[model samples]
Target chain A: MTRVAQISCGTEYSGIQWLLSDIAERVGIELVYPEMALSRIDAACKEIGLRAESPSLNMMMARAVSTLADPTIKGALLLTCFKCSEGTIVKDTIRRYLSDRSDMPIISYSNVEKPKEIELYARLEALATLITRKALLMREKQEGITMGIDSGSSTTKVVVMKDDEIVGEGWLPTTDPLKSVDKGIEDALNGAGLKEKEVEAIGVTGHGRELVSKHVNADLNLEEVSVVAKGTALLSKRHKGDATVIDIGGMNNKLILTRDGIANSFSLGGICGGSSGRFLEVASHRLDVDISELGQLALKSTERHELQSYCMVFGIQSLVVSLASGVKREDVAAAACRSVANQVYENQIQEMEMRPPITFVGGVSLIEGVKKEFEEMLGVDIIVPPNSQYAGAVGIATLVSGI
Target chain B: MKILVYPPNSLILADLVERAGHEAVVLMREIGEHVRDAEIDAPPINVTEDDLKRALRYVSVEEPAGLKGRIGLLTPLLDKAEASVILSDAPPTYGCMGCAVADEFFKFLIRQRKIPTLEIKYEGKEKLEETVKGIMEFLVQLPKEGEISEKKG
Candidate 1:
């Protein structure tokens, strides 16, 4: 069945196109590419003597309209970038065209370098849910909840899952991994309204996984990378395809390239305070701003002041000097975000052929500024899944559910 | 009195020195300036032509070329100090471990100047407190004005 038609600019970054394809595959939807739809639209427009103001926008509109004509195509998704001025100019025209012709569910999203993955996923999930609800009604409900625990170097995440859906989740800073894991598990269990004995199984992952496993008697003790891959794949299953996953945690950053549903290749940042969560936290402390507010503040920047060094100590000093020289806080914050993005790109991404539908996960993915910087630098729409910081935990939960 | 602390990047030592009401002159302050203003393309260390040339003399005993540069960078800071606090067992902190050669040179320079020095071993919490207190007491008892006490016993 024709699941959905994806309309996008021909010049859209290859990574994003790959992601769209992946999402379509995951959701078991057929995607009619713009090229195929454009040919039909071009022929029709020629016959009707219609002239489009912007060729790309015209093509996108034509493709969307033509694809939706097929009764099998349940939904239409229009993908455009923030930098596409032509798309912006003709947005209303396309909206009018869709509203006038198509009764099917349609979603129009403007892609940017840094997009909130959670919000985008929610919208995508809603659309998928809308299209697949009837089919879903025939499936059997999953029994009992399973617990997944991630005891990372900096934070502990616990998730309780009932089949494919997350039932309860909790996260806490990891002062002592053992204590933090216990607390996180307790909190998650409490939220799920279950006792320890009620949980069918428990799985664990992260830097402190072994430490946690030694103390917590988990059914499965999975490697951090494998679990992360599983979690990313599960969350993004609605969009089945390959993506480069960038996970920046407290002490380290991991770059995993997923092909189909498996990890094809991966690289890790060295043991330095240069491109991890610690760097951002230290920068936040030096700036006297809460880390949570850094991204929004960065969005307000009119100009960016790039950090001269990648080292956290040096970066903090540059920040101090920038503040002293009357530079706006937002600009400095934006610059700091850019520096981190640059470090990750230069040190890791540069060495790898990063395919798109790139997903950013882990604690640092929560930072909007970092996401924005990654998007801008990578020149693609980056997808951040919901509860990104708990991706490893979620992955472990998904793994144990299968058993 | 200005007290030069070894492993110049120790923020804890810098904070303690300030708390004790004495100028804490550490090499990291100078290094930090370079790191902060360094151009995006510049190396981590901001080594000038003069610094490289001056550092060349110390290259013999210091096998690594970077250590000589660090020694040259720290010489001026060491020269201006009236006293020295050598953190014997303190682990190297961020931006502080440029060159082991420079660390050895720093000690030699302090001895050549016959500056009032206190060597403290940073072990446990209680010992660290005792060491800090000892340094503070030593700073307080140092002779006033231009009289540099001849290497206190």
Candidate 2:
């Protein structure tokens, strides 16, 4: 007889959690656990059978691991919900504990959607069980694969990987993410030359993932921030040490810290609607210039003026006044750069006491002036990865492969 | 050029001055904060001649705040012109006070034999303009010699 164990982070009446429980019941996987602390897993298991314990995450995942060691257990699954970062730590800890033993299969998942896609959920559960069962036959060895999709307000990305190698990557404007996500998935799938059925599991990450996932489902749904760290780890071949990802998109900013290929602490902005990329786009259109030329022009500025306006409307007026006064365009450019760099510095950098090498990601990261201004303002080197644009997609690919 | 002047507190009025192409100078920094604060509520506050003088000196003479010390600020500038217009975009009580102050100041200039041919028009709008026509239509009606003289005393 096969025993399958399911584990999940506690849900507080979220729609996704209810769907996970419903799907588990339909798939005939016993929903044997509730949200608990690390210490409780041992006691939960003593009532059933022996299980493994997670050293990092508290009692939430202890029962699943302890139970996985039983020869009678055929498969195991880990479940999590959205707005959940602690789940990553739990998954990482469990993976580390099960690194050597492959007797019974184990899988990890984050709830993607509700009951309608229960079959998709069942297939993934079955795949996880199959992988675990297959591993027991192999000569003690480990394999990894990952895939990442970063669906942002302005852009969408996809990356596919086989082990550590980046097989395929893509970055495109996020005009209509549903269509773009499909294209991204197709690109990554084709690059890997793996059919939908051949791929053992799928994972998704991003702001627009909820809508994007409707077009394509994943075995796991992860938060965008963790995925960025995962994607950057795979793409940061240019540097040697831990790197910070400064993701400046049309609407928000994220600062992620990665050390030795793991995300430690990360922070994100409150979507206040004003930042470098959006500002540059508006300024360039108003000045009737291409955005690409904005940075270079700002770099040439010699005169400097403080932009006194607190909002965009006021800023526009100030710019007009400066122009009337014949403030050198270079000075205006420098001021513009300073304005954007200052916003980033005040909101993102002030909180971090330690300065680390910064990596610029997202669409805005491509702008030369923003990067130059950030470096000039901080007095530190800014790192822009070659594949920075596709980091999220790459991270998704890494996740798909790693499991 | 058409202009709209909403001299809500007079700073806006000063901004309209340069755009209005008048020789009016708004001594910005010299203007006291209390006078501005008072102007926002009751008509011309308990401002003394000394306080007005102190306020006028530091104003961006050409900016909004420079038009302190009432009508005198407009006297020299009005005298130098062949024609000038003033617009008021406030309630009747406050607008009349501002208009009376300007009339008094214009007549004071005339008493000193500094009066110039000036036209003042008054109208109202939901927003202020900074153009000549807008100014002529919104706040000041054509200045009459009798009204101007009566306001001066």
Candidate 3:
């Protein structure tokens, strides 16, 4: 079948690629990976006098624009991470460029570390619906529904899928994993307009997956890392390349290296909360700003202050002092983001032999300031996928469907 | 009068001491000189060659209980002080473990110097006012020659 072209940040996409693939499959739309369109992008860039720059986002955008220009490709899906530096910087440019150059429908979406599953599913479902409608014009098929429950340390996410099409989704802050799971599932079922019996298979993943799966009775309990890899591989399948997935959560972070669509090696970091979502939370509290607004606030900074302390406890103190010294709050926020990025790079990323296409997943990747700092520090354009925070849950659901 | 304060980074106590017509001496102020843009809350301290040598004199690397480094850092401040305003119940604002060790060593060094000191807990409202007054009174009452004839335990 002729496919919808997907152009995404390589790193972020790897985390939740599986969910997109599943959605595409169900919608009767094949996904044309941007990697497959690199040559076309290069040719287009040369033909249009566009200079390819160091760091891959520009090149990626070129590939996306060129790929979507193809007559066979039905539409384009632009998957971005919340507050992703490159995404924020290039999204408008890509949209404007594509809109002016091509008549293909271009849909843009963002993902964060914490899964906002309901909203994500709704957006994906709409896109799938659109793709399916287009596919119906060319003749296609439909599939059954499957359910996935991700009981995270900080939140719970539930996604109900009809084959690749997301039927319903729900997410809530987790006070009690069991209760959150029950609530999320209930909400997802209601949203999908389906009964529990209609869900052909149920899968669970995340820190609280075992607890949730045991209590809720799931058909499969998948490892969070494996599922993340599978999901990422599915998303990046069109690339036909490798990626190092960095999934930073509230409590822990993971680095998974993928080679030939397989997870080759992985590392975890959580000894200190300095490099996790908790660090940003602490900074937000100290600054007396809402956590959700921190990214936008940080982006306003022209000068980045230096937060030398690696420990969150010490870092907050340093932040307070910096604020007291008349430094701009935005600068301090940016500095804090840089400090977190520095800790992660020094402690984790430095240890790994990172190849191109580094995918930053987990909840922390949602922060634009953090993403920008990571890019500056790593000297590379990091890819952030859509619904990055829900990669594990989506991956588990994919695994369960395979069974 | 030169007054030494515990935790070395309490801006409240330092400002209070300065207002009471005495020079407030804190080791952190000295450490801050070596680092750029050091904040009042948490000063980034880099132990210099001179600091390491001074610290080694009081505590050896073999049995350095972490107290010796603090003692070495605070020795210069303690030597210049005629009195001390110790916030006995003031929790360490930052670096609690290191501050705790420094607190003990500071008290020990103050006793050896026979300096007149007022130790009080941080209480809110009227109690805080009374504590500040008490510290001011104690510092003002010290001999003009900068000597406390009898140290009170």
> How well is each residue in A145-174 modelled by candidate 1, as lDDT tens digits?
888898888889999988678888889999
Per-residue lDDT tens digits for candidate 2, residues A1-403, read 2345555443211223344445555545554453344446456445433332222123444555565545554455555442234445455455435533443344555432232363335334443334332322111111355566778777677766665666666666677888888787788778877665655556676778767665577765655665665566656653245567787776677676554444444445543445646776776666666777877777776656766652456765676677678887667666666776677777666534333767787667776777887888778888888777776666666555545
Which consecutive 10 residues in model 2 chain A have the weakest lDDT in total?
Answer: A133-142
Stretch of 10 with least lDDT, candidate 1 chain A: A134-143
Cα displacement (Å) at residue B103, model 2: 56
Best candidate according to lDDT: 1
Q: Is candidate 1 or candidate 2 better by TM-score?
A: 1
CA shift of A98, model 1, Å: 45
Local accuracy of candidate 2 as per-residue lDDT tens digits, B1-153: 212122323455555554434333332322234347654331223233343354344333332211244432333333344333344334332223222323344444444443332334444443434344555443344344455568877
The ten-residue window of minimal lDDT in model 1 chain B covers: B92-101
Candidate 1: segments with Cα more than 4 A from true spot: A1-144, B1-153
Task: Please tell me which predicted candidate would have the highest TM-score against the true structure.
Answer: 1
Model 3 reaches an interface RMSD of 23.0
TM-score ranking, best first: 1, 3, 2
lDDT of 1 at A249: 90
